[model samples]
Target: MNAASPKPVLEMRGIAKSFPGVKALEGVDLTLYPGQVTALIGENGAGKSTLVKILTGVYQPDGGTIVLDGTPVLFPTAEAAMDAGVSAIHQETVLFDELSVVENIFVGHQLTNRFGLLDWPAMRARTRAIMANIDPDIDPDTRLKDLGIARKHLVAIARALSVEATKIVIMDEPTAALSYKEVEDLYEIVERLKGQGKAILFISHKFEEIFRIADRYTVFRDGKPVGDGLVAEADTNKLISMMVGRTVEHIFPKIEVAPGGTVLEVQGLSHPTEFADISFSLRKGEILGFYGLVGAGRSEVMQALFGVTHPSAGTIRIEGKTIQPRTPIQAIDAGIVYVPEERGRQGAVTALPIFQNITLPSLARISRHGFLDLAKEFEITRHYAARLDLRASNLSQDVGTLSGGNQQKVVIGKWLATEPKVIILDEPTKGIDVGSKSAVHGFMSELASQGLSVIMVSSELPEILGMADRIVVMREGRIAGTFDRSAVDAEELVRHATGNTAKEAA
Candidate 1:
């Protein structure tokens, strides 16, 4: 506890919000002290996003009292909230690809000249100053599209820091897409923000992150505040029980399935820049895991296998047949399907109804000629939705309306409807809550037991260790090592991924 942080910089009391037929938040309370990181722990649909939306003024609360530095206030709009020194860096980094770094930072509140014109020089100088505080090497004039994912997050952080009187900064699942080293870098950035005396509210599903950076914790469950305490006094099981309203005994739930013959094989798969000479075999009824650090070509290899990217020098074979898939349709026809990590953008169409999203890839099966079969659509939708435990009002509900975890379920269900022989899940449980993760893991085991080949690419060590029958560790665009469940541990995976021997003196 900091001596200076005697009181909370921000407080929410009896906060309530509701949608048309659902109460998103109910009498929720949260307290954030200056210079201290408060981790908001919860399962998806725990009213965490609702509370955040209310705080950011995206949704005017149905009823609540927001006390800022002991003075009650209301934010009529998002800009109003930001102007009042509340800034948030979301997981997706709401930014424009065409805009420059400086432009993104000073988007709405641009520095203007005396003549009321856009002040480029002043904005650049200010952007430079802000970027220097975060990362000096980021060019202020670079287009947002030119930078990688981690750097984009950095720019978003810098934008948040640019708030003239930043009293509170909110980070929502900020490390979802980041790798090992990049995540460590983000931790350093967070520490720097803490040093600057900013009240931080970090939202994450990963308990490791909460224990690593947060001083205090606030747990939410089913639209209400369930518990609040110091992070040092909590453990994973305690937090999980509070978040899910039950003890999640089996987080992984990987069932032992005997492997069959090779269903899919990638021989000498090569991408000019992303990866090289990637050779692996996925057997029927086996869960093969791909583990790697950022830029280690994990996702790229999956993309190539799914025919999203062209493999310059590779041979793809399915069940003894050498089939070259140059497109996703071809891959699907060959009984291969991909469920991407970015479920928001790549996996699911948020605007579409759950039934529509699920039936999109397999329209032929559910459609007669060019006419869509409504009954068939609902039949397929309900089946997979139930299989994945997708929580929604109905199949007609927009996928976007669901929580992040449910959205992931919809994506997984959509791909499962295709009835592919082999499935490639890229960070399948990336931002999913613990309860939802268990369901997905159980489903993976069930699929493997049914003789469906599975390739799971994940950054979480526990997930790989728990679910994978075999693991192929990648380092610098190549296979570092391949190991069985009995042969590899967490330390061994990290060592291979990082090329560190980690030799210890006895």
Candidate 2:
């Protein structure tokens, strides 16, 4: 530590929290110094969210002390925490889309005139001033919905700054959905915030972002603090070990398999505004990777192939037979299935039971002569559920109640029940813990070994590099490049995906 460096502005010691049948946190400690960014990292169930909630006053710690500037304090509510100069911008922006940017910035604490009327002019001017520090182009009078995701995030930060006394800012996964340039813009804003002497608590799963922005690091595992130190002293392997409690030897467990004849072939696939002239072929037992940036039309192409969206012009061939599917059911019937990107919304029916979700795609096969077969349903569900190592209270347990990893397994199991020839997985490991991600990777390898053709669409380059035999890079609705796994590196793949090197790499 530097001799002239400031002391921590906030200190959390011996924090403990629990819910029924689960101890979310135990004896956790975090220290945030002024003008520094501290990253809080862990696997999905590792108590990071619980600790953040406690810090934000959404949950009072079961045991511990929060010391601010050498004095113990308690924040009984979210407003109390904010009043005490702590504010958080969550993963999802919590702003009213119907309201204007100015109204959102000063929602609950609007400035009023001496006559107790809303001070519209003062609010607008103040909003503009605050936004200028982040992005000068944003209009205070525009509706929140009119702005893009990155601007909405700026508005959230502007709302935080509007507090006037916000000494500490908690940004939770702020760049999860942002484009590359938007992420760079946010990094600039963070630097400005630090320059203004605000302590920052940054939470993110992406190690690249953490290494880029954080000065200090604190890692959690199994509800307790395992390590804390300067980011300069930590490497990716060390951080992954701290989070997962073991050396993860391989994150992508891809198994080599001799591919058979083409199972699915697409020719001239086009979706008006989404994508165009997409063509690819998936061989039996092969893993084909789709690599791209956030809006490079990767997911759109996969969705079209699964019949979620009709292609304006295309030809789809399964085996040697030409087929055109107008709906998901028709795609499934033709031996094609898709596990969607937003698993919570499109992959599984959260309200339904685990077994029900698993057997959802194969209901007709499990049903008897125009009648439902409960026994057959349970049998089919249990089979794939075991294959995927799905952990839940029971098959009857609500899928919504399971952890993200388990829920994802249920989604995969649901589709596997169909016994499809081609499976398209869009961002399969997104928002999942490392252990779960390893398990999912193992399962993918197993499926390929069993002669199932897989198409993985991912923005994460490491995932694509580690698992794919061949990668197709997309840029702005078109295939920019194609590469063999042995011949291309991440830099080359990224260059192709960003159109920096538009020609095929190999």
Candidate 3:
């Protein structure tokens, strides 16, 4: 609603899309004005991605009209959309590893000279110019794989800008994997784009990021537009209500319990390059929270404790028994289970049936004389599935077909079958919907109440403050501070996590 903003460069009206069993989008509308960032926000399955796909020509809307610059248009293919001045930079980079940075920026539309041959020099110069506009120091001739994740993202944005006629650019969850500094860099680049008179569609679940860069706001829920307005006029609570259709009463659902004896203890744990001298203790029926920024080594320490990585120097004791686990199977055998952050890759086998995924870790216990017991597997799967309130057509359905929250439940269910004494969850509710997050949090509380010690590794401050009985903040591979739940303060936790100040507590 900025009066200085130009008219809308692109508009979608009455967009509706559906599959056999799903209505992905229903009559959703959006307008993108030049020199403004319009944030598209919603839960995991709230049709944000569906709308992006429609605009990028990934899926044709069953019903809708797309207008650009006072003219109606239909993009039958992704290439057609780009040629018509609409480009999208997805969450995952689409660059080839073998290609150089210059080649990646102009891969699809290469430059040609008068002789009709590939003009490598011209492309390299153009790539350099684009890189200068963003980072100035990124080498255009470097291979794509040599750059870090942040630089790779920069290349993606530069690629979008390389299009001569690009008027609208869609960035979908661009900062999901970025570090704090990387996120700042992205915000700077977004501002530069806005200055260039380009309309940007910024899709993100992080409200902080939305407030940082977005000028306009739109909220979607269950495939329909629920709210749309200027960012200046909206607050986080208002946006949350719009996204979930109700006020989320208890996001964390933490339950108070008297701490019992120590279930797991780590002393002087060290990894060569990841973490150093990390130590913590988890009591029975307690939720221990590990808080840090991305790459602060929280996940690395969890990975080491879970046997995904070995510590160079450390002692791990479970229930007062010293043990060293060399592999994940060893950790599982010792009654320690991990729910990894990347659920799709490390947690569940998407192509496998839901029952199979749940029972995969505990197959040894359910089998008879080395032969699989199908009935036992089904029974165990049903027990945990029902406990977690997992939703699916049937237990035989592929795990890939479920939503993000359900898939996370399936991962947790698989580990719960082991009946581990201690469970480590890395970013447990990440990328899940609000309702699903509440369910997951409630399940964690239930697990703790049942005398299971939980170690939750998360970058979200609210989750740490809300759910933790004892919070440990990490900074650059070391324990910076620790505080009891009753003494928790957001500013203090953030200060420790970012190394602004260290206040180690008893």
Candidate 4:
């Protein structure tokens, strides 16, 4: 680590928090030093979110000491956290779409003149100054909706920096939506902030990102601090061990099952603005992996297949029978299911109980003559939850209260309960912990083994390589390349995904 500060900027000691059916955190401790980035490492349900929530003033700790500059403090509300200089930029940048960049930066706390009026010029200047530190090209007057995802993120960080007292910055999967070059820019911003002695709490599931940007590491497992050290002293294996409490021999445990006849075929699939000419086949007892970069239209293809969008022209064949799914009901009735990437938004109804979320699609089955069958709902939910080995306190637990992993399980079970012949998982393991990812992967294998045809759309090459029987690479909304497991490596996949030559990808 760089010459560390003698005193930590913030410290948490013996933090504890519990819920009705879960102990989210237990005696967890964390320390953040000025001028250093500390990686908060953990598996899903390991209390990382709870700790962040406490820090951000969204939740009060049941018991703990939050020390700031050698003084204990409490953030009873989100406003209090901002006033105390604790700011977070989430993976999904939460900003208004129609608002101007300057307005977003100075939304709640706009600069005022002596007359007590909003000082537009002053705010614009400050916005420009903040953008100068990140991107000089972003116009302060530009509407936020016009900028791309990466620029919106820059604005989110700028808004955080606008808080003059922001001493500690928390980045939760900030690079999840960023491209490679955008990620490089974020690293530079991080380094610049560190130079200014701003303590940073970096949370991420990608080990490569942690190794590249973090100086210190703290690992949490089962809601408790298990390890901490300089990142320089740790490797991928050691960190994995800390996160999961076991040697992670394999993240993608691909269980082989001989591929049978084609179960689903996509021929001449085309979307008006998303993807086009998508042709592929998923075999019975096979995992067909779709690999692509952001905006490569993998999810679009899946959405179209699931009847979320109408394909301008396409033919979908299930077991040699061609069908067009114009609505989600049609898709489900035709024995097709999709698990979306945005688990919090689209995959699961966070407000509903676990059993309700699982049995939602199968509601007709659980209901007779329009009367809901509560017991049958529980029975159906139990079967799939057990199949996925989901960890939760009870079937009545709200899906929102569960960790990322359990939430994902609830979504997957919701679809599987429909008894679909073909399942499309779009970024199935995104935003989940490593252990959760392994569980999802293993479950995918088990699904394939049981003759459930799977179309897994993932941006992760390692996952595609490990679990896919055949990989189809998409570039700019079309199939760029196709390869079997034995025929492709990381470089080749990158080449196809980016339309890059071998040397260019290197």
Candidate 1 per-residue lDDT over residues 413-462, each given as its tens digit: 88889999999999988887899899989999999999999999998999
Backbone Cα, N, C clashes tallied per candidate: 0, 0, 0, 0
Give the Å error, residue 433, model 2: 2.9
Model 2 has an lDDT value of 0.88
Q: For model 1, name the residue pairs that clash.
A: none
Worst 10 residues of 1 by lDDT: 1-10
Per-residue lDDT of model 3, residues 261-305, tens digit only: 999999999999999998889999999999988878988898887
Candidate 3: pairs in clash = none
Compute the lDDT for candidate 1.
0.90
Which runs of model 1 end up more than 4 angstroms from their true locations? 2-5, 502-506
Give the lowest summed-lDDT range of ten residues in model 3.
1-10
Off by over 4 Å in 2: 1-5, 93-111, 121-162, 369-372, 502-506
Q: 1 or 2: which has the higher TM-score?
A: 1
Error of 1 at 30 (Å): 0.7
Error of 4 at 240 (Å): 2.0
Error of 3 at 428 (Å): 2.0
lDDT for residue 334 in candidate 2, whole number 0-100: 95
Q: What digit string (tens of lDDT, one per residue) describes model 2 on residues 1-506?
A: 34355888999999999988889899999999999999998987788888888988899999999999889999999888988899888775578999999999999789999999999999999998988877789999899999865578778878888988888999988876666777787899899889988999999888898999999999999899999999988999999999998998988888989899999999989998999999888899999999987778888888877888999998999997998888888999999999987788799999999999999888889888988799999999889989998877789999887877788999999999999999999989876777788899999989999999999988788899998888999999999988889999998988887777665558
| RMSD in order of candidates | 1.5, 3.1, 3.1, 2.3
Q: Evaluate all candidate structures by whole-model CA lDDT and list the values in order.
A: 0.90, 0.88, 0.89, 0.90
